[model samples]
Target chain A: MSHATRRNILKTGIFFACCGVPHTRAALAWSMSADPLPVKQVADGVFAFAGAPAMMTRQNEGEICNVGFIIGDDSVAVIDSGGSVVEGKALIGAIRAKTDRPVRYLINTHMHPDHLFGNAAFKSSGATVVGHHNLPRALESRGTYYLQSYREAMGDDLMADIRIVPPTKLITDEEDLDIGNRKLTLRAWKAAHTDNDLSVFDHKTGVLFTGDLCFIDHLPTIDGSLLGWIAQLDILNGIKAKFAVPGHGAVPSPWPQALEAERRYFDVLASDIRRAIADGVPMTNAVKSAAQRERANWKLFDEYNQRNAIAAFAELEWE
Target chain B: MFATIQLRNPLVAVVLFAFFGSAISSSAWAQNADSPESTTWSSLKGDVFGQKFIEPANGIVSIEAPKRAEDAAIVPIDLHFKTDAASGRIKTVTLIVDENPSPVAAVFRFGVDAGVTHLATRLRVNAYSYVRAIAETEDGKLRMTETFVKASGGCSAPAMKNSDEALANLGKMKLRVFSSKSSGMEPMTRATEMQLMIRHPNNSGLQMDQVTRYYIPAHFIQGLIVSQGNRLIMSMEGGISISEDPNFRFEFDAKPGEDVKVEASDTEGKKFQDEWPLASSSL
Candidate 1:
C-alpha cells in the first residue's frame, strides 16, 4: 500500500489502543454516508475538486464550483468551501482522509454564492474565515437575498444549515499566511468579477486560487466593472504562479494560458459595447446582440452573456 | 419590512393590480382563475385610481419591455404617446412595476406644448411582474398599456454591482443629445432626443448592515425637473424601484439655441443641478 495510507492506518490504531475507545457508531455512520468528494492532487500536498460546468440544482447538490484544500506540515487551509453545505461536508471528509491536521483557515476568493455558500460547514472546525475587506459589505447587501433566492433552485434540504458566515479575518491589500511551513499570499483586487475579489497564492506549490477572477469554459460574468476587469487582464496574466484554480473551470490549470479564453471574450464584449455606445444604440438593444460571435465557445453563454452585456452597456455608457 | 407588508397589504395590492393585470393574464392567471392574480388587481385598482374609470389603450399609448428581463436590476421600458385632438395630449404617465416594494416607479409629467412623443428608462424588477404605463391625457381620459417581464433568477439580484464605485461618483450627471437622423419628419413635427444619466446608488433600503443590524436607509433621487430656456419639458417624481444611475431618454420638440437645464434632489436632501447649451437643430 501507499506510505501515507499505511501511516494513517498506524496512527488510527495507536489512537484506539492508547485511548481504549473507538469511533462511535453514529460518527462512523456519518463519515460513511458523507463520502469524500473525488479530488485530484494537482501539486505535492495540494488537492482540488474540479466542479462540473452546470447550474446549481438539487441534482448536482450545488457542486458547481472548484473547491480544494492544501495540507501543510502543521495545519491545512481550504481554498474555497463549495456551493452548498453538503459539498462542504464532503470536502471536509476529503481533507480528513488525507491528513489529521487542524484546519487553520477557510479562505474565500469572493462573495459569490457558488464560491462561499459552504462557509457554515467550516464553522464546526473553528477555522478563521478569511476574505477581502469589502466582503462583509457585499454580503451584508446580498446575503439574505441569496439565501432566499437559492432555496427554489437548491431545495430546502441542501440549504438547511447554510449560513452567511462573513470572514473574521479581512485582507485589505496583501497578507501572508503561514499554514505551518507553507506560506500563502492573499491579494485583494479592485472591482473586477465582483467588488470583493480576492486571490490566494501558495508559495511552496505555486498554485494560485483565483476565485471568480478567471473563468474558463464558462463565460466570464461581469457583476463588477467591465473596464476594470479588462484593465486588470495584463496584471492578472502577469501573476506569478505555475498553476491556477479558477473559480469555475479545470483546477490547477497552467497559469497565464488559463486566462487566455476569458481575456479574448472580455475584449470582444468590451469592444462591442463601446461601438454600440458610440453608435447611440440604446442599452436594451445593444445588450441583446453584444458578443454574439463568442456564443458558441463557452458554456452558459446564452444564460450569462446578455447579463454581462447589460452590465457592460451600463458601465461603458458613462464614457 | 416594507416589502413584506406590501405583499399582504390590500392598499399596495390594489396599486399593483393595474400593472399585474397585463402581465399575469398570459401565464399564471390562466391556470388558476382564482389566483391572487385576479384579486390583487381588482382590489388594487381602486386604491391607485380611486373612483376614476380606466380604459384599455386604443392606440393612444403603447409600451415595450422585454418578455423576460435579462437583468433584473436594469430592465428597460419604452413608452410612446400619440398626439391626437380626440384623445388629446397625454399630460401625465405613471410607470409601475407591480411586484416591486413600491409599485409606483415614477410619475412623469410633460410640458404643455413640449410635444413629447417618446420616453425610455430603466427599472429594477424585484420579481416576475407586470410593468405598466398609465397615461392621463388632457381630455380627462386614462389610457393604460403593460407587459409581463419574467425575473432573471440566480445570482442576479436587484442590487448595486459596485456600491463603492456608485457612491464615489454619486450625483454626477451626463446629458447626450441625439441628432435627428430620420429625414421624413415634418419641420414642425421634428423632435430632438436627449438622454440624461445620473450617477447614484438609488439604494432600495432593503439591504441590512450585519454589524449594525439596521436597514440601510433608502437614498434615491426623489425629484427631477428638466426645462429648456425656462420652458418646462418634463418633471418626474421617482422612487427606489428606479434602477441605480437613473437614466431617462425622451424625444421632444425643441426651440433652437435654448439651454436645457436639469435640477434634481435625493432623499438625503442633496440637490444637484446642471445646464447644457442645446445644440442648434441644424446640426
Candidate 2:
C-alpha cells in the first residue's frame, strides 16, 4: 500500500482505539483546539515558529528562542517551548490550530531558559518530556540562578508562571521515537554549547533541529568548550539534511552552508588563543586582542568575545 | 590623597605608562593614564613604601596572574622570588589590588624560617586595575612589579557556597606540606612547599542569601599570621577578594622539631589559632 494509505489506516486505528468507533469526528476535534503562533512549513510535516534574533527582554516577552512541532499520522511532537508561560501558551495555541493530533512527546533541545522555560504549558497535556542525560543536573544546578536573572531582566509580570521543568526521559546517546509513520531521531552531544546539548532529526523530511549549535547571524555565546564546539561542527557538516532549524535566527536555513560562520568564529578563537599562549601573553591582554580580527565579522562580538577569550585562555594555557 | 598629587604632575602619567605599557595593552595603559582614580606607581610607592626607594623587580620577583580574569571574584596570583637566602632574604611582600575599595590586599612579613619565598593565593579585583606585588629584601631595599588586569564586579559577586553550610564550618583550616619524595627519602636541607586552607565564608557583602534573599554581611579574614616555633614567617591582611575559603601556599624551611603555628583573625574579631609539628609526614 502507499504511504498515505498506511497513515490513514493508522489514524483510523487510533480513532477506534480512543473512541471505540470507526467514524468519530467530534471526538477527534475535541482532542485539539487553540490558536498557535504562525509558523513556516519547512518540510512535508515540519512546522517552524522562528523567533527574532534578539536578546531576551521585557519588551520581547522572552520570545528570543525558536520553537516548532512535527506532525505524524497518529500524533505530534513539540520541539523546545519558548522562554516564558506566555510564549508557551502561544505555542500550545499554534500547535492546536495546526493539528488535532495528541502531542505524544515534548522534546527540549537543551537546558537553556529561552528554549525550555515554556515546558510548564505542556505539562497538563501529558506529553512525555525528553532531553539529554545531563539536562536534569544542569537545570538543578543553574535553574534558580537563571530564574532570578530572567525575572530581573523580563520583569515579574512576564516571568509569573515560569518554572524549571526538567526532562523526564533522558537520552544518553541516541534514541528514535516513532510519532506515527514518521521517526524522529534525538542525539546527545558532548560538552559544546553546554554539557547537556541535544539535536533532533526528522528522517522523512531531513530537517535537523540544531539547538544552539548553529548560529547564522546571531553571535554565539561560549558557555562550553570552544575547541569542543569546533569539533562538533566537523561532525555536523557531514549530516545530510535538506534544511536545518537553528536555535536562533531564521529557521529552515540551508544545511552545511549555514554552518560556515559559526565554524569560522570558533576556528579564529582557537588559533588566536593558541598564538597568545605561545607568545606568553597574559589573559588580560589576550581578552582584548585575541579574536579581535573577527570583531567586524560577527554581531555582539564585543560583549561575548572577551569572555570567550578568557575561558579559552584558561583551558589552553594548561594544555 | 594621591588623586590630588596626580593632578599636579602630568609627567607622572607618562612615567607610569612607560613602566607598565609593555606588559599591558595600550588601551588599558591609556585608561590608566586618563582615569583620575588610577593610582600612579610613584603615588602608591610613597603611600605604601613611605620613604624607602623601590627598585625595579625585573629579575628578582615575578608575578603570575591572568591578564583578564576568568572569574573576577577569584583571581589566582603567584609570587615567585629568584633570589634565595644566600643572595638576600625576602623580608616582606605586600599585595595590592589597585582599584579595590581597600587597595591594600595583603602584607606578608617573613621571619628567619623564610626559605624559598614562593607564595601563591587568590584575590578579588573590583575593577579593571593593576595588581602590584612589592617585595622587601632583608637589607631594607624594596622591589616591585605590576600587571594590569581586566575584570570587574569582583567585590559584589555572590559567594559560591551556601551560607548556612559555610557558617557551619567557619574558621576551620587545613595544612598540607609537600614532601620532596613520596616515600623513604630524608627531609631535604632546603625549604619545602606548604599550602594552608582556611574555612571561612569570606562573604563579600555583595552576595544575597539564597534562602533569606538578603545581602550577607561582609565578614572575611582580616589578618593571617604564620609562624614557625617562636619565629614569625608571614602575615596577611585579607579582603573580600580572597575566595570563600582563604588559601595560602608558600615555602618555608622545615626545622625537624619546630612547630608550624598559624593565627588568623576575621573582620568580626573572631580569632583562630592552630599548631602542627613540622615533622608530621601526612598532610
Candidate 3:
C-alpha cells in the first residue's frame, strides 16, 4: 500500500477507537427483506429515489441525495447510494422488491457524503463499489470531517450507521459496465462540483445521472472551480439523453434545458466576480454584490451566494 | 426592633414593587431594539482598555472588515493609519475582538521609522462582535475605532487545509516587500511596504478531528516578534482569531539591505525564526 493509504488506514483505526463506533464491516448485512425505499420509474428498467429538496437535517436524516438503480435482464446496476445506512437499506429493499436479481455494481457519482455514506449498506451485497479516480483521495481527505459534522448536525441516532465507504473500482476518464443485457456508460469529469465528480448514462433507458452537477431548484454550491464547472456544463449539454436525474431536486428533468438555471447562476457569478476584481472592489463588497442579480432565482441564495463570491474572488484575484 | 420591623414588612415591599417595576423594564427594552443584549462599546472599552483615555479618531485610524463575513474563519481586516492629524508618531496598534473567547486578538508595536501604516491581515471572529482597533501614539495618547462584524462559529470552523498537509510545512515563512515608488517602470526608491506570512494551522480547540472524531487540540502561533537589526519593530500576541496561515502586511521605514528578522512561537512552545534582506527597489 502507498504510504498515504497506510497512514489513512491507521487514522481510520484510531478514529474508530476514539469514537467508540464499530467498524463498518462489523455492521448489519444488507437484507432483501428490509423496508423498501420509495422510488419512481422514470424510464423502462430505471428507478429513481428522489430525496427531500431541503438541506440535511435530523428530520430528513441526510436523505437529500437522489439515488437510482438500473435493472438489466440478469442483474442490477445501482447508481449513487443514499445518504445513510437506513436509506441504503431502503434502496436495497426497493431494488429487491422490483427484481430478485443480484446487484452487479454499485456506482458512486461523486464523493459527497450525501451520495456515498450509504455504501456500507451494500457492502455485504458482494457488489463492487465504483467511483471517479479522485474519489478515494477526496474521501480520505474529507470523509472524517464530513462524518463528524453530520453527527453533530443530525445527532448520533440519525447518523449512527453512516460511514465513509470508498469505492473499490476507480474510473479515470470513462468506462462502460455491462450488467447482463444493459450497458451503463460512466464518465468522470474535471474538477467541477468537486474534484471527483462523475456521471452515469444508461444506454437502454436514455437516462443520465448528473450527480450534483445539475441542480434544478437548489442553489449550486461552488466547492470546486467555478470556471471548470461552467466548462463541464458545456460538455454535459451536448450529451444525448431523454431524461436527466440530478443529484438533488426533481428527477427526470428534461435534458439540456434542466442545466440552464444552474449554468446561468454560475455564469453570472463568474462574470460579476471578474468585474469586481477589475473594479478593484474588496472581497467584502464583492461578497454582497457579486451575485445579487440572481438573488431572486435560487433558494438558499443568502446562505451560499456570498461564500461562492468569496471563493471565486480568491481564485480569480491572482489571475 | 427596627431591623425586625423592616424584615417583617419585606412582603409588602415586594408586592408594591412587582406592580410598578415590571412595567417600566418592558418599555425600556422596546426602546432599545437595535442594540442587542451584548455589552456596548463604551463598557467594552472600559473592560479592555481599563482607565486609559481613548480619543475618537476622526478618520485618522480606520478599520475595514466585512459587515457580514463570507467565511468567518478567515475574515480579512485592513487597518490604515494616516499621520495627518496625529500629534506624535504611531507606537502601537492593538486589535480586539470584543466577544471572542480571548478578546485581545493581537497587539502590534511599530518602530519610529515605520512609515504611514497600512496593514492588511486576516482574523477569525468567533461571534457577532465589535472588532476594535486601538492605536497608541508615542506621546501615550490612545485613539480607537471599531466596526461591527456579523459572523459566528469562526473559532470552531474546521481548517480549510488538511491537518497533515498543514503540519508538513509548518513554520515555513515568506516575506515580500512592496515599494510604492517602484512601479516597475520607475527607478529604485526607499522600499518600505512588507508582507510577512507564516505557515501554521492555528487550530482552535473547537474543531473536531475529521479522522479521530475528537477535538483537535488548539495549536496556534502564540507570539510573533519582528525586528530590524536588533531594533524591535513589532510584536503580536495571537489567539484563535488569527487565521491558519498568519499573514501580516504593513509599511515600515527601513533602509535598503537592512535585514528584517522574524521570530514566532506556537502554543506548543516551538520557536521558528527567519530573516529576509529588504530589497532596495522593486525593478
Candidate 4:
C-alpha cells in the first residue's frame, strides 16, 4: 500500500476511536469533513468558498467550484448551492450557527449540480429558491433520471431524505430584491452558462456574484455558447464590483484581477477552437489536443484539463 | 510501540471497494459464476432498460463491450456477432446501460439481411453505469456481457446554447464518415462506426430562462430512426438525458454507392431529416 493509504487508515482509526459510540456511523466521514472549504472574506457581510469536498468542475483552478454567502440586514442570501445535499445542509448549518435569522433567499448561480443540487435543502426553511425562468424546465426534463442515479451512487440516504422543488422565484432580465438597507440587483445574463445564468450584484457593497461566468483559478466549462460565454465574461468584467464572488475558486482581492483570469482562460479556449477549426481537425482530436497543450503550458492545468477541453469543443463544433 | 499497519489517508480504499463491488457483479453474471453481487446489478430489474440475459447453448453469437468506461456520461459501446448475410441472422440490437437513470438508450431492428456481423451504434451515457447489448440472433439466444463504467454529473450540464437557439435548430443532424488509415472493405465493414449528430435542446428543463419570468416548458428529442436507402436499420426512443444537440455514432451495412437517409423527432415538435451519400473516398 502507498504512504497515503497508511496515513488515511491512521486518520480514520483516530476519528473512529473518537466517535467510538456504539451507534452506527452514517455514510463516510465526508459528512464531518475536518476542514471546511477554504474561504475569502470578500466584503464585510459576504464570504466566498470554492464548492467542495472537492467537486471537480470541468472549470476553475484545482478548486471545488464556487459557493457564496451574502448577509443582509433582514436576512441572508446564499449564492449557489453545493454539489450534494450534505454539503448544502452544511453550508446552511454554518450560516444558522452564525446567525439565528432564517436564510430568506437561496439564489442559484446556475443549474450545474455543484451550484444547484443543494437548493432542495434551503427550501424547507421557506427560503424561496431563485433562478432564471428556464431553470425549472431544465430541472424537470433531465432532473428525475439524474436524481435516481445519484440516489444509487451516493447511497440515496441524503437525496431520499430531502425534498427537491423548483425555484419559487424566477427572474427574467433583471430583478431587484430588497434586503432592507441592502439592495441586491439580480441580472439575468442570457445564453451564457446555460439559458438561465444569473448574476447578483449588491450596490451597497459593490459585490457582484458572477455565478459560473467567472472561474478564477480553473478553466471554464462550456455547456452553452463559446462566443456567448466569452462575451458575457467581457460584460461582467465591465461591471463595477468591489469584490467579485465567482461561481468557483478564490475571490480575487481586486475585482479586475479576478475578471482577468476568466477572460484570459476563455480567450485561450476560443483561440484554440478557432485554430482547430482553421486546421481542419476533427472535433474529438481538436478537443484532445487543446486539453493536452494546456495541460503542458498552463498553471493548475490538470484540474479541469479534460472536461474543459471536450465540453468546449463539443459546444463550438456542434454547428 | 503498538503493532499496527498504517493504511494512511487515501481514497484508494473507497475506489477499490467500488471497483470490487461492480467487477464481481458484472463478471458473475457473464460467467453465471453464482456470485451474489452480479445478481443484484443485473437483475434485468425493469422494462425500460434491462433485458433478460441467457447465454447461448449452441454458442452461435456473442457480444462485447468495455470492461470499464473512462466516463459514465459518454460510454463507447459496440456489438459484434458472427454469421452470413443470407440467414438474416441479425434482427435488432437493443442497448441497455442498466445502471443509467432510464436504462434503455436505444433499440435498433433491421429489415433486410444486415448479415451475421453488422456492428451496431453508440448512445448517450447518463452516468457511470452498466451497458448490456441484447442481439436477437437468427437462432435465439439472448447473449449478454456487461462492464462497469465510472462516470457522473452528465445530466446536470446545461444545454449547448440558448433555449431559443437549441429549439430553433431542433431536428437537425450531421452525418460524417472518416477513416484513420487508407483501407478498403475494412472501413465499409465498420458501418457500425457511423456518427449521427442531431440538433435538439435535450432540455433537462432545470435551466433558468433568463428572459421569461416563469420556467420554460421542457422539450427534447423522443424518437430517432436510421435507414439505409429505404431499409429499416435502426429505431430509438429516449428522453432528454440524450445530451443537448446530441450526436450519436453508429454502424449498419452499406455499399460504396448506398444512400443512407436519417430521420429524428422529439416530443416537443422538433424534427430532423438528412440523406447521406456514401462515397469510397469519404470512408
Candidate 5:
C-alpha cells in the first residue's frame, strides 16, 4: 500500500481522538477525509512524495510532507526522517527493501524533534548522522522534554523503547561528503527556523533538504526570530536546487516559490503582530487578535498559531 | 478478638493505611498556621550544613532576588555580602528557600567557593515566603537574614514539555569555564567562575497533565559533582528549585588553564557528564 494511504488509514483510525482539538477538526475531516500519504514521484530519482495528514487544518494542513529516496551506488542517503521513530523505521524498512545499498548517511536539516528523534534506529545500522553544530545543543536542551511528551502522548512503546542519540557529526559553516560519487553540500544558515538549520544540496540529483526552513503547503513554524527567518529565506531563495523537501508539507520544484510562500507567512505574522502592538493592545489580547486573523490562511493554526503571534510580538515589541 | 478481626478486613486495612499516609505528608505543611510546626521562616535555624557561615558582628548578607518574579519557574537571586573585613572569613554560606511547599530548594557550599563574599545565582521559588540564608562564622556563631519573595504555583508549572523525551537527554552536561574579573586586585586567591548547564527536567511532580489529569511523578537532580583534572570542585546538593535544565554558576579556585568536568544525575537514574577543556576565554 502507498505511504499516504497507510498514514491516512492510520490517521483515520486515530481521527476520532484528534477531533477533540477545537476549531479545525471539521476542515481536516474534509480535506484529509480520504487518503493523504500519496507517494507521487515529483523528481527524477525521488519516489513516495508523501503529504502530512493534518488532524486539524489550521494552516499547514493541505501541505503534506514527503519522505522519498535517491538510489546511490553503494549506499543510499534518505533525505529526511518522518515525525516519529515508528514512521522512521517503517520508511527505513521500505528503503532497505528497495536497495541493499546501505542506508549510509542520514542527513537532518535541523534540530527539531520531528526530524532528529529517529536517529537511534539509523544509529543501530551504524549510519553516521550529520547536522549543523548547534543542532546537538538544541536537541540536548529540549530532547528530554520531547521524550516525556511522546511517552505521555503516544505511549511508552514509542519513547521507552527508542534511545535518542544525536547526530554524530557537526558542521559549522559548510561541508561536503561524497555519497556514491554524488557530492552533497551541507550549508548552514543563520538562526531562521532555528539557531541552526542546515540544508543538504546534491550535485547529482540537486535535492535540497530545506528542513523546516521551506514549507510548501503547511504553514511554516517560526521558532527562530521571524525577522531573522525572513532574511534566511532570502538566502535560501538564492540557492539552486531541483527539488526542496520541507520540514512539513509538499515537495516542490526549487527556489523562490516555496521560499516566497514562507516569506509571505512571516510577513503576515509581522504585520499582524505590529498592528496589535500599534493598537496598544496588551500581549495577550494582541496575540488573540493575530490568531483570529491568521487562522484563515495557515494550517496547524490551532497548534502554533497563537504561539507565533505571541512570539512575534515578544521579539518585535518587547525585545 | 474484635481488634484482630478489624485489622484483617481488607477494606478496614486500606482505610487505616490511607489515614497514616495522608497524616504523614498532609499534616507536615497543611495544618493550621497558628500551630507551632507551621513551615514559616522562623521555623529554620542552626548550622544545617555543619559549616561556619558567618562571624559575629562582622558582615551583612543582603538578597537581590525579585520580591515577585517574572517566571516562577526561574527566579534570579543575587547574594551580596559585605566584604569590608581585612580578611574574608566566610567559612560557608547556605540558602534556605523556606515557605515553598517543598521547603528547602538547594544549597551551595564554599571552600574554594570564594569571592568578595558576594555571589549571584537563580532558583525556582515555588511559593511566597522569606528565603533565609544562614552564614556560619569562623567564631562558631551563625548569623541569619531573610528575604520575602512572592511566587505562587511553580511545582505545577507544566513539566516544561513532554517528560519521557526530555529524560533522554537527562545526563547531557555542558561545562563553560571562564576567567576571573578581579585578576588585578586579588593577587592571593585565583578564582575562575564556571557554569554548569545540566539537562534535567527537575520536575517536582506536582504538575498535572492537562489532558490526562494524572499527576506527574517527581524527577529532579539529586546530586551534581564537578571536578577539575582530579582536583575536587565541590559537589552541589540540589532540590526542586534547581530549575528545569538546572544552571549553576559560581567562583571557584582555578587558574586560566584548567580542565573542568561536570558529572550529574537525576532522580530517574539517568546520568549526564561533560568536560570543558578550559580556555583563556574572558569570564
Candidate 6:
C-alpha cells in the first residue's frame, strides 16, 4: 500500500484511540467557523488570501497563513493549504467560486502545518500534490509531532480530519507545469525558512508565490539555517517577478520591497547574537534581547522573535 | 496490581498510565502548585533514590529554567551549586525532566576538589513538566530543587534543524574559555569559566519513517568525560533528552597550565576526543 493510504487507515483505525483524549482546552478562547477564506485578485489570473497574524486556533479554524490559487485556462494550481482541514475546505470553496476549472495541482510551499494540514481536503479535487523534494523526509520527522502537539490548541473537533499527506510530485530544482496556455514555474530552495521551501512563479502574470521565504508584516521564523538564508538573499532577489504573494502578511506585496523588513530583522538578530557569542554570553541570556529594537515594526513580535533568536543563536554559534 | 494490569494488555495499560500521568501533572500541580508530596514525585523518589530521606533546597543548590519554553527542543537549564560549612561539597547531581520519555536526563559526577560552582546546559522538554535537580553532597544527603515549566507543542520543534548537516559534521568539538568575572577566586587556582560544544544529532528516535512507518532507533551521546590533566572536572551519563549538539557552559577552578580534554561516545560507539591548552594566566 502507498504511504498515504496506510497512514489514512491508521488515522481512523482502533489504535488511534490508544493515543488518548484528543485535547484539553488551553487559555485562548476564540469562536471559530469553517467559512471560505476571503481572497483577492493579486494579479492577472491570481487570487490570494491573507491569513491572520496569530497562532492557529479553533476560532480561526487554523486560517493563520496565506493560501491561494492561480487559474489557468485549463485548471487551477493552489499555492498552499491553510492550517486545518476546515480552513482547507474553505479554500477549496473559494477556488470553486472563482472558476469551474478542475483543480489540477495542489502545491505546498513548505512542510509547516499552517501550510499543509489541509492536504486531506484536496483528495476529492483530484489535485496531484506537489512539494519540495525534501518535503517527505521533513514531514516524516515532524508530522507526528505536529499532530500530537497541535491537538491541544486546535482542539479535537478541528483536528479530527487532519492528516499528514506528503507530495507525490517533488520538485528537485525547478520544474514547469502547463495548465492550458499558462506556464507556472516551481523552484525548490535550500534550507531557509524551511528545508523544503518551494516557491511558484506564474510566468504569464509575473506573480511570485514566495512561500515563507518573504515575510512582510509577520516576523519571519528561522527553522532552517541562518547563514544559508542570509547567503541566498541575493539569489532570491534576482528572481524577475513584478508582484509577490508571501506565505504571510499582505496578500499581494510589491516584489523585492516585500523582502526588506524580514531581511533587516535577520540582520539585527544575527549581529546582536554574534556580539553576544563574542562576549561569551549564554544562549538563554543572549536570546532575550537579540532583536528587541525591531519590536515596534512587526506583528506577533513577542510570540516569535525570541524563538527565532534561539534557533539563530544555535546556528550562528558554529561560525 | 500494576504487574497484573501490565500483563492483561500492555498497550492499553501503557496508554492509561500515560493518561493518568498527564492528568496528575496538569490538575494536581495546577491546584497545589509544586507540592512536595505530588504523586509523580512521590513515586519517582522511590524509583530513583530508594526510600532515602530527601531535604528541600534551602539555598544549597538552585535550578533555573524558562517558565515558558519558547522552543521545546532546546530549553536552557542553569544549575548553581554552593558549598558551606554545613553542606561540605557536591559530589554528584542528577537532572530529571518529569514528563519526558526518559525522565532521567543525565547523571553528572564532579571532581572532589574541582570547586565547580555553576553549570549551564540545554534539554528537550516534551510536555508541561517539572525539571528537577537532585544533588548528592559530600555528607551523603540528597537535596532537591525543581522548577515548573510550561511548554507544549514541541513535537514540531525537532532537535535537529538541519539533519543532514548535523550528521555531516558529527563529533566536531569546540571549547571556549571566558574570563572570570566573580570575586573570591582561590589565590592558588583562579576560578575559570569554559563552554564546551559538541556536534551530534542526539536524536530521540521517536520519529517514524515516511514509507515504512517504523520508528527510527534512538541514537545519542551516552557518555562524556571532561578532565584537566587527568584530574576529572566533570562527567555525564546522558540520555536522549539532551538537546542536539549538546552544549555545556561551566565554571571550575583551573590549575593554570594543565590541558583541558573532552572525551565523548555515542550510542553508535563512535568516540570523539579533543583537547585545548589552558593558558598559565587565563583571565
Model 6 complex DockQ against the native: 0.24
Give the TM-score comparing model 6 with the true structure, all chains together: 0.87
Docking verdict class for candidate 2: incorrect
Instruction: Report lDDT (Cα) of residue B114, candidate 1.
Output: 90
TM-scores for all candidates: the values are 0.88, 0.57, 0.62, 0.69, 0.50, 0.87
Candidate 1 vs candidate 5, lDDT winner: 1
Model 3: per-residue lDDT, tens digit, B24-89? 221111112123333445556777679899997666679998765556556889999876544577
Which portions of model 2 miss their true places by more than 4 Å?
A1-35, B1-283
Q: TM-score of B chain for each model? A: 0.85, 0.75, 0.76, 0.64, 0.67, 0.85
Top lDDT: which candidate number? 1
Model 2, residue B123: displacement in angstroms?
Answer: 7.8
Residue B86, candidate 2: C-alpha displacement in angstroms:
26
Better of 5 and 6 by lDDT: 6
Candidates sorted by DockQ, descending order? 1, 6, 4, 3, 2, 5
True contacts kept of each: 0.48, 0.02, 0.06, 0.27, 0.00, 0.39
Candidate 3 clashes between residue pairs 3 or more apart in a chain or in different chains: none
Whose DockQ is higher: candidate 3's or candidate 4's? 4
Best by TM-score: 1
Candidate 6 stretches with Cα past 4 Å from truth are A1-35, B1-29, B32-38, B152-156, B182-187, B210-213
Q: For model 6, which pairs clash? A: A32-A59
RMSD for each model, in Å, please?
7.5, 14.4, 13.8, 9.0, 15.6, 9.7
User: What's the C-alpha lDDT at position A292 in model 6?
Assistant: 99
Error of 6 at A185 (Å): 1.9
Give one digit per residue, the lDDT tens place, for model 2 in A1-319. 1322532454335433543433234333533322234566788889887786665766665677789999999999999998877677667765665667898999998877889888888877889999988777566545654665354346557667798898889999999999999999999988777667899999999999999888877777665556678878889888898889998877789998989988888888889999976664544566678888988877656555775676566445534
lDDT per residue (tens digit) for residues B23-74 in model 5? 2332223222112132443334432544334344334666666554433455
lDDT of each: 0.82, 0.70, 0.71, 0.58, 0.57, 0.81
With candidate 3 superimposed using the best TM-score fit, by how many Å does residue A272's alpha carbon deviate from the native?
1.6
**Model 5 over residues A133-180: C-alpha lDDT tens digits?**
766655554455454423322333455445556677788899988767
Evaluated on CA atoms against the true complex, candidate 4 attains a DockQ of 0.16
